[model samples]
Target: MADSITTIGFDADDTLWQNEQFFRSSERQFAAMLAPYFDGDDLMDRLLAVEKRNLQYYGFGIKGFTLSLVETAIEVTEGNIPASVIADILAAGREMLWHPVETLPHVTETLEGLADRYRLVLITKGDLFDQERKLAQSGLGDFFDAIEIVSDKDRSTYERIFTQHGDGPRHAVMVGNSLKSDVVPAIEAGSWGVFVPHELTWVLEHVDEPVSSSRFRRIETLRALPEVLAEISAAYSAA
Candidate 1:
């Protein structure tokens, strides 16, 4: 029998639109500002370490990002940095507000094509209001059958969404940029996953291990997804 996929979950941030570009630009500014106190490598390492440790406390979003900046600044500066420096970092974080739209070269056409063959769901994690506003403005909202703006992407979150949507693990697929947030969880839940590399994926999203399963695949662009899905469907049919 052919493997049946009824629902496809998509990540919104870097997957659908230009998200990490802003973060990358802000990170460069942050490093420049901290140049007097620390070199770029040292400052970035410190910030990455701090963010890894604080993921539980801050979860994901602007709040965590702001805290990472504050914590890193205080630690590296030995509490001697001026209040203005911290204020600037906070301002930078606040400026990260994004307007949603497609980022890939041909994202709209790809989503339009996929929507015809699969049930689509927008699964993103972030500040509720900000995410909602982006979706509303993106003009791509109509493509999704459901929108899940979550605080975290974990096993529980995936399970809950699958259950709520009446989708079985075997019949669902997740497509996104982050391996840590999107791919692993989907695989753990017995769902297929598609990884689309972005220009500015966070260090936390990196995965060291090779993807060994036939169900998990990687593509370079959103435009290539329709063909990949067709291939997957063909393979399943053959089996």
Candidate 2:
């Protein structure tokens, strides 16, 4: 018998609303603030390196990103970096924290349509307060049956979330823009992994598509989600 799907897991950043663009904007601002001390591309490379290393220390979100920026500045300048630059970086991070949450095309409509049919669970990774702020600001909070703000996304994370929120990983569908964080791990956890590509995914979140996975489905936008879900259901029933 085919396993029945009962839960739908959605990713917030970029999948439901605009997120990475703000970080990109802030990065350009950060580069300009330090141009006198470092080249733009070189500074960005250093900043990314620090971010990668600092993920274990600071985790994800604007706060960690700002800290990484400061660390990068201090490293490149050999500790002579100005306090004013650091202040500016902190201010930029605050701006990102307060930035408006602009939902992607068809996000609201699609979620509204699916909420009645499935147990919708939001699974996102980032700082707790910032993610909470974004969810409150987005006004999409009510549609979710449960919200999980985790430090990271992985197979075990999906297993736990799906089991708690609905049925189990085998009965869940995880949809998002990142192939790495949102897709691969969820697929490994025994859920359907649906990829909805976004234009400005962060470099660290990059990963190749799992086209050979029977549970993988790629859609152009959230508008196509219901149809995809129906198709998955049909496949499951026929199995």
When superposed on Cα atoms, how far off is each prediction in RMSD? 2.3, 1.2
Roughly what TM-score does model 1 have, to 2 decimal places? 0.89
Candidate 2 minimal-lDDT segment of 10 residues: 37-46
The top-ranked prediction according to TM-score is: 2
Clashes of 2: 0
Write model 2 residue lDDT over 1-239, tens digit each, in one string.
Answer: 14678999999999999999999999889888888877646777888999999999999998999899889989998998899988998999889989988989999999999999899999999999999998999999999999999999999999999999888899999999999999999999999999999999999999999999999999999999999999998998888
Q: How would you encode candidate 1's per-residue C-alpha lDDT over 1-239 as one tens digit per residue?
A: 13767778999888987777776788788888788776546788888899889988877776687789889998998887788888999888877764334456677888888887788889999878778877887788999888999878887777777667746666778889998888888878878789988878887788843378777889999887877778777766787
Q: Please report, in order, the local distance difference test score of every candidate based on alpha carbons.
A: 0.80, 0.93
Model 1 RMSD in angstroms: 2.3
